[model samples]
Target chain A: MYTSLFYKEWIKTRRPLLLLSAVFAATVAYILLNVAKLYQANPVALWEFIVQNNAAQAGYLKYLTLGAGIALALVQLAPEMQNKRLKLTLHLPLNESKIVGSILWFGIVALTGLYLASGAILLAGLTVYFPAEIVSANLLAMLPWMLGGLAAYLFAAWICLEPVWRQRVLYTIPALGCTSLFYLDALPGAYLPFVPWLASLTVAGFAFPFYSAIRFKQGVQ
Target chain B: MNAIIQCENITHYYGNRLIYENLNFEVMPGKILGLLGKNGTGKTTIINILTGFLKPRAGVCRIFGEAMERLTPAAKSRIGLLLEGHIQHTYFNIEQIEKFYSRFFPKWKREAYYELLKRLQVTSTQKISAMSCGQRSQVALGLLFAQDPDLLILDDFSMGLDPGYRRLFVEYLREYITAENKTVFLTSHIIQDMEQLIDDCIIMDYGRILLHEPAAHILNHFRRFRFTSDADEIAPADGTLWHTEKVGNNWETYSFASAADVQRTLADGGAAVSGLAEERLSLEDAFIGLTGKY
Candidate 1:
């Protein structure tokens, strides 16, 4: 049953997922090519500049992950809400909670795979021109942004699953507030100490969609 | 035999406005019951509550002897639902949707679905979103038939269909239900189409049910009586006649009473009756007569 549910989710999301993947790849390639050009011009100066200014050199990738997360959730979930189509899904011959959980799990798993591949490419690309310390630092700096992206996906699910427009607007305030914490500082290692808290927030975001699903089942308007 | 669908004293409100109160109805096995009502009379509301999408304010609905709000998966498997507008996952192609739904149902009838789809000029790879309203309705009906549920709840089945599609739907549905002895509960604004399909009906007025009887009974018993009177005014007692309108010397009213009884009642009300006639009504006329064509 879960596999079938995932299959439906995959059908709805595969197009947007592919589009986001292309965008991610182009963004990563653009960031890496710029880094290569700078290294070719003067490798010592680039390293000295990075060490002194604590620049992650991947600032352009900041909102790219977050946007991917939000886009994936919309493609995966918006169809279910259209024309109150979720009623058809909820009416399926399965436990409603299990059905909703499977849908969310599919989106989360898909997003995780995309993020890992994109992050890995960025890490490996930088390793060729820089030492291990700078590569590790760059990876750490982007970690919170990726976590923020996951949180945004879950939060977007909550908003889209909401049955009422007014309540959805109300939910966005808190969702935006919580996700903002992931971008407080973009410097390398700055978010390392707050990683646990951000991860906790992402975990907590998963529960919000269930609350919305409950309201949807209750026919709140 | 237990009722396939039952509702006890369902009361509901939208904010301060009351949609209905103490509303009650039941659908017995092998019976196709149609809920007929004007706009905002809680026809779809009842469907929503029965399917557990909307929680009523003051009552419980049970399907197959289980509370609607907590229907087990086993119970859910025995029911099929068609939402308003025949809504489905428009993103999926014809074949993909079948593949998606076939996994969950133990009794999924793949041939039943394809048999209906064969009537349409659509390919297996065609997306449902690209279909017209009529075509979408066919797909929805095909899916419901494929589910092979014991009870089917359809909301506004005839909403967007042309005459040809409507006839096709009613004929197909009636044939299927008769062959399988399936119970059906549905609503439609098109009373003529419903007349050819429904075995029984629940006609609803605002906040209450006006009548619940077999379609044959309403067609055979309830009628319109027109008479010419010489008196200046003719007014029968309130309960004896409905929507009485007097134009010039002709008077028209509707009731379940016989022509003799109507004449007697009008004579007692001090009107001199001359030519009196009772006219048989179609289901649409009967509906309008009972509910006062407002």
Candidate 2:
């Protein structure tokens, strides 16, 4: 049964997942290509330039990662909400919580996988020109952005499953507030001390979708 | 016979407006029961309660001898549901959806589903979203049949179906019920399709059950009566009469009692039964008579 569910979701999400991954990878490659071209222009100035303006690089990636999270959540949940098709899955013999949890988890996994893949490629590409410290610093800076992506996915799922437009807007407020914390300071590795707690909290954001699914089953508005 | 479905004192409300109070009904084993009501009369509300989609404000509903809200996975496997508007996972095509649902049901009958699908002029590769409303309904029904459940609950099955499609769907359902002898609980405002299909019925009006009896019994005992009365006079308020509406000086009343009983009630009320005639009524007429034309 679990395999069937996974396969069903795979079919529905495969197109969007591929398209999103391609778009993200292209953005990362474009940024790195510019970085490499700058390094070729003046080796000494390139290193100094990146070290001083590292936060600007982080800013570019942060918004991209957040956008990816919102896209994944929309791709996974919007159709189910469209015609109240979620009721079809709720009618299955499986537990309601388990069904909704599985969907949220799947989105999280897919988002994390794509985010990590793009991040790794960019890291490896940068390593050829920059020192290990700079490369690792950039990776640390990207962690909070990825965390924001997961949080956004969960929050968007909650918003999509919510029946009332008013409640959905209410949910978005807290989600935006939570995500804003990750973007507060763009210093490379600034959130490193809090990564463990942030990761745990990001995972806990999944509970919102569960609550939404329950209210949906109850036909609440 | 065992009660496949039961609701006791099922009271529900939307905010402060009471939709129904102390509403009760049952679906006996192997019997097809139709919950008939006009728009906003709580037919769909009863269905939602039974399906555990909406928990009633008060009262309890049991399916297969267990509370619907807490039915176990095994208990759920014994039931089949066809939601309103014949909603399905439009993402998957015919073969893909069948394969997906086949794993969840222990008694999944692939051939049963395919056999029904064959009757439709749709390809196995056709996605449900692209199909017409009638085609999608057939697919939904086919999926339920493949599950081979002990009970079937269908809500507003005729929502967007054309006349020919509606008839086809009803015929297929009738054949399935007769062959399997499974219990069915359905709600439909469209009465003609359900007239010959339901073994028993519960008609609702003004948040109350107007009639609950075997179809044969309701047909035999309950009837419509028209009698002319003086303009200043009112019709008799007898317990047996379910609803009464007057057009000009002529009064039409629906009664659960026999024709003779109706005449006796009118005569006792000091209203002469001079033009009293028992009008033949189909189930649709009986529904409108019980729920009135609003």
Candidate 3:
């Protein structure tokens, strides 16, 4: 059952997913090439700037990943809400909760995979010249952003599955607040201390979609 | 035969406005029960409740002897629903939707779905969103048949279809219902389409069931009688007379029993009647008379 659902979601998301991946790869390559150019022009100055100034060249990834995650969730869920096709989905023979969980899980898997791939691209590009510790620090700084991406997907699911506009606006208040927490500061390794708690909170947000589904079933709108 | 779908004292409200109150009915096994009502009479609300999409404020609905709100997955598997306007997962192509649904139903009839699809202009790769409303309706109908459900609840199957498509839909449904002998509960404003299709009907008005009877019985027994009477004369308090209206000097009464029964009712009420002739009515006329305009 989940296999079929995954295939269904894959069909819906394959185009956007490929496009996003291409864009991520291109962006990483561009950033790496620019860094390389700077290094070749003035290697000593670049090294001093990086070491003394704590320049986070990879900071662009924070919002980029979050945007990708939000777009991905919208691509997956907006149609279901717009035309009320979720009603057809909920009528299927599977347990309603299981059906919802499966769809959300598929979106999570795809979003998480894309985030990880983007991270790998950035890591590989930076590791060519940067020291191992700098590369590791840059990657660690991305933790909150990665967590933000997942939370954006979950919150988008919550917002889209929500039937009433008034309640959706109310939900957005907290959703915006939650998403903003990940971008507090781009300092390298700043989010490391809160990593465990942030991850726990992101995982717990999955339950919000189920609550929306229940309200939808009850004809809340 | 036992009841397959039953609702007792099903009352519901949306905010301060009551949608329906103390509504009650049942669809017996192997019966096609058509729910007829004017717009805003809570037909769709009842459908939503029956499908477990809405919880009524006051009553219980049972399908296959299990409460609707608590229907198990196994129970849901036995019911097929064609949603209003033939809503579906419009992103998927025909082949994709077939594969997705076939996995859920153990008795999925792939051939049945494909056979129905063959009659349409849609190709296997066509997305449902790309198709016209008529073609989409066909796809929705095909998927419902493929599920092989024991009880089919069609909520306004003829909503957007042209007359040709509506006739085709009813014909195909007739053939399937005869072959499978499954129970059906449906709602439609197109009374003519249902005239030849439904076995029993429940007509609703103002949150109450106005009439419930076999189609043949309703046609044979329910009659419209027109006669000249005093403007101030009131209609008889007869339970069999569903409605009465005064137009000019002519009084028209919609009776649920027979012509003689209505005459006896008028005489008993002591209202002097003249030219008490029965008027022939089609199902649509009867529906309008029973529910009234506006």
The regions of model 3 sitting more than 4 angstroms off are: A48-53, B230-233, B267-270
lDDT per residue as tens, model 3, A1-221: 77887887888899999998888778778778877987999998778767653655567677888888888889988888876778777877788999899889988888888888878888888888888988888788887888898998999899989989999999999999988988787478777888888898898889998999999898886
| For model 2 chain B, the run of ten residues with the poorest summed lDDT | B229-238
Q: Provide the overall lDDT of each model, using Cα atoms, as 2-decimal numbers.
A: 0.90, 0.85, 0.86
Predictions: Cα RMSD each = 1.4, 1.8, 1.8
- Which scores greater on TM-score, model 1 or model 3? 1
Task: Please name the candidate that would achieve the greatest DockQ relative to the true structure.
Answer: 1
Taking the candidates in order, what DockQ does each have? 0.89, 0.76, 0.77
Can you write out model 2's per-residue Cα lDDT over B1-294, one digit (the tens) per residue? 668998999889998889999988888899999989888887878888888888889999999888978777888899998888998999999999999999999999999999989988999999988999999999999999999999999999999999998998999999999999989999876899889699999888767897798877777766898887763465666677756667776888888777888878877877665587787778888777767788
Model 1 misses residue A86 by how many Å?
0.3
A1-221: candidate 2 lDDT, tens digit per residue: 87887878898999989898888878888878878888889878776778677723444677888888888888888988887788778778898888898888788889889989989888888888777888888888888889988888888898999977899999999989988877667578778888887788797898888888888888785
DockQ (C-alpha) of model 2?
0.76
What number of clashing residue pairs does each candidate have, in the order they appear? 0, 0, 0
TM-score of each: 0.97, 0.95, 0.96
Candidates, ranked, TM-score = 1, 3, 2
What's the true lDDT of residue B15 in model 3? 88
- Reference-based TM-score, model 1: 0.97
